[model samples]
Target chain A: MCVLCGGFVVQEHWTEGRGSTGAASVTVGGGASRERQRDRRDRTAMANRILACYGLKLEDWNGSKYIVRDVKGSSEIVHDLGALWPAVEKLIKKTADPLDPALIGRLQQQQQQQQSGRP
Target chain B: MAANVKIPVIILSGFLGSGKTSLLTRALKQPQLANSAIIVNEFGRMGLDHHLLSRVEERTLLVGGGCVCCSMREDLVNACMELLEDMQRGAKPRVDRIIVETTGLADPSPIWFTVLRHPVLQHHFHVESVLVTVDAVNGMLHLDSHDESIKQISAADRVIVTKTDIADGEEIERLRRRIGQLNPAAEVELTDSEDTKSARFFADNPDSVRSPRTRCAMAAADGGREGRSAEDGRNGSGGHTDATHSVSIRFDRPLDWHAFGLWLSMLLHARGTDILRVKGLLDLGGEGPVSLNGVQHIIHPPEHLDGWPDGRRTSTIVFIMKKVQPQQVTSSLLAFQHMLGAVPYVLETDLQFPY
Candidate 1:
């Protein structure tokens, strides 16, 4: 399991045994299964969990190749396993807009005033 | 740009306390490297004070006669650009070679990308080699614990094992073997040896190194399926859950270039971060032999060698990766080749088999 993200890390070994060509296959996680239904379920579950964590939703899509619409109505494709993290990060950034310096300073002053009053 | 006049730059990288500075100090003293410019990155803890004891200027020092040492103030590209400008303005001494010594925990790929891919730098500078200093006494422990050390060893063209005087002979041998496993193409030299010369660090011909076959042969003899974990048997050291591992694949016949390229592109796209280094000598049907070198996601344009390094004309590729299994790489290549209908050889019984 990845500690940073609460995703289950799977190590699936797919071996291609041929006569003495001596090839090896190793994959970390994602899209290794040949069963389309299972692959779809796994990818959707992972994506939905990531989206929920960032308070977003998948509005629409055309199969797994492309994401037609998200909560923001953006048309984008989740190309491969590697693209998942970047997509999540983008969604998080969009949701949690950077706080202004003045606003941050105001919040800090208010907290200090409240603490002083309690004392 | 004048032809054959680019300044050769060597990137000296190692983990903290790996004796990179000591090696540089010795190398700078050599008469052959007198006119060399050394760009040393200042470590937060050490602060380059030892190197700055004899300063010619604020951030620059003249060490060992004519060698100029400057502290890297900003990004490597800017530092190198400034050095070049200084030379042009006659502000700094003229130099034939430049050595960029990275911080202990630095990743060499970015520096390499800067040198090789930058438009201006590429035109004026050529990568001479990547020289890594590995401490013989604590090298194995460091490799087991630190990802930086693994990347340092993996990306090296030449590895200088220092502090061998204090390390156990058997332990040193073990470390040497492990280093070979991590990077088979690199030439390993002991710094403690009397015959070891500073000039040898600068002397490297990518073509002269032994073929991947010689290294892969050992793995192939073991049937290539068994994976050896670097963490086994060592106690009290940091765990190697994310340690780097190596895989060597050999093809008996020529490969389809287009098919191989497609597979490699897809693979890098998917697992580029995990892949530290990929070096291969390829046999492409009638096109002859070519060398493929890659660090992380960046694949340098392939170089065509005059002939095979060894008599063996087979295609062999060695991949050093972190948290990646060797079996997955080999099978994926074979699968891709099979899909493209470009499988090199076929077995008599299994018509669909891809070899």
Candidate 2:
């Protein structure tokens, strides 16, 4: 059990390609504070792109957990990026498929926009 | 099992009648694997294979009546947990390795899931390798017919071709070629009765899997080229209707581990079944590159290598896939890698949901 968030999260989450762990519980250990925070923020940002596909928004909560909320106000407290997808699915009732033509198109377009200095 | 202690697990899979039992029996007799336990899983109402290898006695547990991949997945987990419990309680002798011999029809992915996904099992056990057996006589026919056989071959770290005495030389050659086309990274060998004993294979490898060597072999298959599909010169891709191809991608810049993990996790979540295996030597701007490997949805924790094998700063990743579009992987990975050092201040709201 993690003293930080009360669950066995992360490290395990980082290895999970299945993208489904459960509930809200993240623990930060090792590494310098700045580097760790930056990784967390980057992870959250990458997740926002996928979650937005399902009308869900993700935010880092106190650096220990994440808050995932849908446009409809239905929300879930996710433990880490690994646990975010299922929470997004539960909130929007659909698979947040990365290979979905729609999602890929958006990610590609977003990359293009970022490249072209477009907001 | 303690929190940090890990045990090695070898998943032995083969098509029905591929001589898995005979090989396992011979393996148990060897000194290298003598202190090993077996968990034999068989499909159907009863399992008789466990009785055949009764030499291991209490160490051999029979998980019967259902496939390890589907129906009796929990039973497989229980069997593993029970092995740990038995050893801990002194009911059974402690062993160095656990070999889960799946029924011929079982897919190794779910068995991997049963170990990796279980909270206790994940911490207590680590899958060392997937060893698949292919009998030379019908192996080609099975690969030409069965998807399970194809998956077993694709997931293999080592392939043991059995019954060489009965199988003609030419037939064995074809089987070997097909196995290569299916998985170029797999180390294929004949069950020559001396090779397994000599190499000290599954039982002896207590170290992490050398995915770098596997990647090097995969790259070498394409003549050491990058971005080319390894699908050419292969007839029909080992009975798969679609081209089961491998694509090698190179990155000139360093990879941000966090971002790379995120992209891969998302990709695996949706397309894991189609994407069979991935091996990469990632350049994290460190003195050495870290190795990343995945079989379907289960990506093993990355291991850092001493240094680049080729001494190149450019990171190399190879993907061996079945039915998945290479563009799906390439485009997404490149897009994510672009943000390695760029400020991620841009929010999701900034990009229009074009889809």
Candidate 3:
């Protein structure tokens, strides 16, 4: 159980890895707290790009939790990336096949557009 | 359980006739092992009824995929939990270590998943290593005809080719070569079980395999990974379509932890079973490299080292996989990084990348 808010303990997902306490300095001089927020933003944006394929959005909630919502505005609170994919599959009602050729093609197209500075 | 120490679990796995029991029996003779608990599949299999101290009943858990073998292995996590509780309550003697001897056809993933995923168990127990034994006499035949054998070999941190006393050196060499190709990171040892006190016996250096020494990263030669189908295809599982294969990729710079985690979770959610195991040291540009270890779908909680083991920050990950195309895995990863505008990763074959 958590001691701070007196709530149930949260299982640290593999994705969070070492988390902020043990986090390495990805942003050289950004304080650990700032680096953590930056890390959270990067995750939200990157995940949103992929979820766009399924018409979904992910928001970094308080730099600790994530809210994944579908095009229909249905949302779920995901503890971490470990729970995000399963939550996604439930929202879309389909296998979130990461290797699906179609999904890969979309990512490829977007990557190329970014390379050429295509807005 | 102490906040700083975790009990180590060593898993013994291999084909039905492999010398797992024999090795354990021999090791138990050591006075130091008095504090170790053994979890065998069944008493009949171990033939050590008197040694069976306690039996842990199976408890159904809402974990892992819904498969018959998976459900049975859930009992393994249950066994470990009960053992922990008994020790804590002084009902059972506290063991410094756990030795689990899996069934001949057991897949080590579910047991690993449950151990690493359980909120309570994860804190008290950590898998030290998976020691796989192969009978040197028929090892080649088994590898060529059994998918289970390949899975066991791939998941091993150390592969003991036993029964070498009577087996032909030629056959043993061939089997060892096959194991190396399947899992280049696994150290293969030739052991004549008759020589019970052989230098390669267990407990000499139980930490030998888990020493965080990352394998050298290199591109796999094409066509080296081809699965030898099992003789029986009637099982309808489409079991061994993709031959056991491994690939290692290195990133010149450190990884963006956020992106890496997202990509990995998506991959495991879709194709966890295809990935037999993965190990690596990822530099999140933190104080030290973050170690990553996983068995199929379940990943052990990452440990932040005090410093880089070799004073280098290059990230290298080796994936022991099956049926999954290595190119697709790398391409998707690179694509994710590309979207984040993070440094693009180089792979063995970037051409297979749709971009």
Candidate 4:
């Protein structure tokens, strides 16, 4: 389960759809098109916000494949919900900066300065 | 001011099997690009062909049938700087232009940012344009299923549709229309077509590429649409829900730069990941026109032009975003402008009336 959104936890190798190997197979469930749309929007928003924390973006394509692109590097296609975490982890490991901790602090300081109307 | 004599750097990007290598191979045969340097970024460990490599020196290799090609051994800045260093040390031939061909799955924006932000590189080089190659046979499918393809198309200054001979004419036409909808300002040309010669790809000046005629056509297209001024609302029906789209905004009068800057910074901060590319020419009051370029979270420092490229002085901004609505961007910008106490001279009614 997602801690922030209480969404269903993704299972490993959970292939549930067809068309194109390595395409994401996770489907959004529930009745009514409006509800389904709303659910998807909410889920995407949540996923995007969480992914930003790790410097990744989740792009859904063809309602079948989830492309996780590194904001600073390459991208990987996630075929199932279970595979998403591992892909993201691999990307983070591949692109992580050694000075990330200091970089985050510097960024926070800059944001605070900007908010306070300082140069 | 002497540093202003910068070599134009063109970015060549495309998805895997989009024929970028083939296009480059053909283009290098031209006399215009003979003295040019190429930085090739290949993904994975497999290297380029051995026959294509003719050992010119340790740092630079002369391709058998083409111009100088250097495999990008490090980050873009380092690679470019190394080339410059080689030139300074008289170890490399004098080159007029540089071309950086990114990996198939790479995003072009970061490379653009690197060129713009690096002090040494920016002094010696300028980003001329972003050229993207799309495979005509598999482009529609790739555009529908790959966000990378969408971003590449959106970020392109020129979209080259390759493999047209193999694909059906109807499929090619459909792909062309989709490209137009995604980036009305992009100059789309078929690779196999007679008009789109290899030498002419990056031959024109940047200002000429985004000419007034292209902007007028884009304005006309957006004007023909209903219920929106900047948005292209193409529904994502069928099985695809997250459709990549573009929004073009035009202002009749000059805008307050401070207000526009704030609004853009906020938008990028909030949804930079979704925004594949943002390119615009802004009319700052009393300051002439300035050009803005951004990709993902990185925004290049604005470049100020001496005067307008064409007769029209209108400010035009094109945003290529994924999953972000046009209304959201327009409304936010309008709201910010209002909060900043900057009243736009032209009204929505004026846009409709056109007189």
Candidate 5:
């Protein structure tokens, strides 16, 4: 347990919904669509940051792997959003067990506001 | 270009008033260095050396942020990338190698570590050698009085005694012995004619062969892993921030880039003096890992690389600063994460950002 942040491990919403249902319903509770969307937004943001550093424009490609052409030679740096998004989602789920629906809903609202350039 | 051609980096280091610039001026005249790229860091008010060396006015990369490796390592790397890109774009004589000249009062560790730790650099370029020059006229006095001078000697792969034409033979011999005692592995070369050949200096070493200095560096990296956690954040011995120290910041998930950009700009602006260098592999929302770097006030845009060399989830940012609190820097960074609703491990509040 990290003394810095209280030992409180915030469970993933899916994990909490099921974990509370006892042993019989443990594996049945999958999370709402809200948590998954948050994961995707976070992953996409990560991708954009990576592309920006490489001198590549995000609007250049239609959301697929691209090649990073440098002066030395042209090397390929592929960004497969399909593969990365899921992994980030999995990591979010594992670190926090028994996730909060209210937090997920707030995060979704934040995401929409971000997409709309509101806040 | 098909079969991977490794990039070669040549380090030029020396003490104050030493013949480092003089030697570089001499080396640039050589036919071998005709197509090479030079990275220079500035510490003094006047930057006459850049003007002096660019007699050809071809392509001279002025790394004015701070000390290379410590404060300007990322800038050095970015400069190298730009140079490489220029070479590919049919700009010059098609140069592949790079020569980095450190400031007179600079430590060689950060530069050395930058070369060692960079993933792209390791794949593209290998550190050919660390060549340090000692001034024959005031060499002994500088070595005796300056800790920076001692470090320059200690980390040398090759030691060149300059201005031998004017100095007494006995005095030159004494200086040679002192350098040898500090580091016996480095081969000592004496030159007064300024006719040192670039081919002769960096030729045999190549990237394949491992020299004594490289071996020591490898040993230091391995044996010093324990100290890395502590030293990574500690400030350096220099009263002015040393660029070699790095601050590592890890994120649990991808961060909000806008917040990150704001935080970075704020950090760089507030502590520009202390922050000599910044570089990291960032997890862009949906993208893999993007590498970001900044030197002094200039964050050289950004470079979206091919992919992580390995599947490392955690995002790491290293800051080489002087006389700054690592905890404060870390907390400031954490505040950015907290704004994004990410909880980070608050390592230590008073952790030294020593390099």
Candidate 6:
């Protein structure tokens, strides 16, 4: 199980893609979609979860595009994140790149290790 | 697992309007790229290229931010995992190759490192090549004006000259020569920005196209600015510019899996803010090396590929952080090693409960 938004929430046995059994109701727990918003991290995780339900491979790279690839094996367990209208609304709306520096920094460090033979 | 499959990623990097995306959209349409996956990193709130590619099988992940080498790397790794998962779950189309179309200001080094260093990612992916796209119409000017541009050229595994349709061929050739001097090993291809399917630029198997001399080029020349960490300045204290950066850690021996996870969780809980990405490739005893990657705070569930994609045996970890001391991180890892019964340490609990 992966913790999202600093473990403020817990999601286990997450559905991998969106199902075709009629669309899921867009209401999140808070009731109002327009007025209420979770913390940024939680919102992004929620978006990830939503993508999971849609059965789409949810991929994000800090900026604007969020990718959803179709899953391969079992159609039942997969949930689609984009299928939930409310979830898509949330992810598309939240825009911030928090892990940018770390991603590049680690890569440069690896290049150094490979060159120097440092384990 | 198809052990015979070798997916070599060719990265097209350059600054905006330099024709990076243009070249990629064109490359995807080529018949040779039929088995390729294209991952695009877009900047800002809206993505443009996601809707531009004509191939349905070309997986697209648009990451918005400063540059892929820094900010959106987790997404890059996660994208790969999801692509694999999708393949396994029968959700997404499967491809034999991959390509990452970077933002204009992207520094190709980090993107390359993600594939080369991340424990989980390193196995399934390889830095087959780094293709830097240069806008010929503004090549010299861009190089003279931007520090990022210089880094792009220096790090390229291949240099592609774009927008030659608008510039004089002689001047474009001169620009090509300049690129060659900066990156002597890279193969330079001049392309008309608008033409995508021209046979002139496409190759059947890009992985086999490198010259023997280029393949044998000095590691120092390819090292670029990343090598400067030891010599550039700042007293060799891992002379890093950004506080939150990624560093890869490796362990050759089989990890005490439980201990390693405990150490990581404790570190993340305490300094998660400073640490942005953590991906490990490890010898988990009987199961082979399992790959795990985390972004910001979300760790994708660990996945096991067939085996090491290459024969290399070091269990590695690439850490992406913010301002935390590398020594502190190293020491903590060392402490974990000692906890693994490899080093002497004073402790109360034998096989501690939490770990």
Models 1 onward score TM values of: 0.60, 0.75, 0.79, 0.60, 0.40, 0.41
Off by over 4 Å in 6: A1-119, B1-4, B43-72, B194-203, B206-355
Number of the candidate with higher TM-score, 3 or 6: 3
- After superposition, candidate 1 runs with Cα above 4 Å error: A1-119, B1-4, B43-74, B88-94, B193-196, B203-238, B241-243, B286-288, B339-355
Better of 1 and 5 by lDDT: 1
Reference-based lDDT, residue B61, model 6: 31
Clashing pairs in 2: A25-A79
Task: Report each candidate's C-alpha RMSD, comma-separated, in the order given.
Answer: 17.5, 8.2, 6.5, 18.3, 17.1, 17.6
> In terms of lDDT, which candidate is strongest?
3
In candidate 3, the residue pairs with backbone N, CA or C atoms under 3 Å apart (3 or more residues apart, or in different chains) clash, namely A24-B286, A25-B285, A25-B286, B227-B243
- The parts of candidate 3 lying over 4 Å away from their true place are A1-10, A19-38, A62-64, B1-4, B45-52, B55-74, B91-93, B196-242, B306-312, B339-355
What digit string (tens of lDDT, one per residue) describes model 1 on residues A1-119? 11112122221101010011112447556545444444444445433432443445542244444252356666445443334434544544532211223323443454456568994
Worst lDDT 10-window in candidate 6 chain B:
B344-353
Please give the DockQ score of every candidate, comma-separated: 0.02, 0.23, 0.35, 0.02, 0.03, 0.04
Q: Where does candidate 4 chain B have its weakest 10-residue lDDT segment?
A: B62-71
True contacts kept of 6: 0.04
Reference-based lDDT, residue B263, model 3: 74
Tens digit of lDDT per residue, candidate 2, span B1-355? 3212467778889999997877877676667776776777543323234322222211222132122221226666677788888888999777777787878887776666566656677777877678899998888888878888888887787788988888889888767766665666567778754445722555554453443244443342332332212343344354453456655566657766666766666566556567777766666677766666667756666655565655665566667777776665555654455555322211111011222
TM match of model 1 to true structure: 0.60
What is candidate 4's CAPRI-style docking category based on DockQ? incorrect
Q: Write the per-residue lDDT of candidate 4 for residues B1-355, one digit (tens) a residue.
A: 2323567788889999898877877676666666777777653322323212121211222122211111112366666787889888999866767777877777676566556645477678877778899999998787777767877887787889998888999888777767766765577888863333686675554335333223433343233233333222332211342555566677656765544543454355446567776776666664456666666655555655545544567677777777776655554454334323343332221112231
lDDT of 6 by residue, B103-200 (tens): 78766656654665455665666555567788888877776667677667656645778888899977786676555434433467778857756423
Query: Candidate 2 at B323: error in angstroms?
Result: 2.9
In order of listing, the candidates' clash counts read 9, 1, 4, 1, 50, 64
Q: What are the candidates' interface root-mean-square deviations?
A: 20.4, 10.0, 7.4, 21.9, 19.8, 14.9
Model 5 stretches astray by more than 4 angstroms? A1-119, B1-4, B43-72, B90-93, B194-199, B202-355
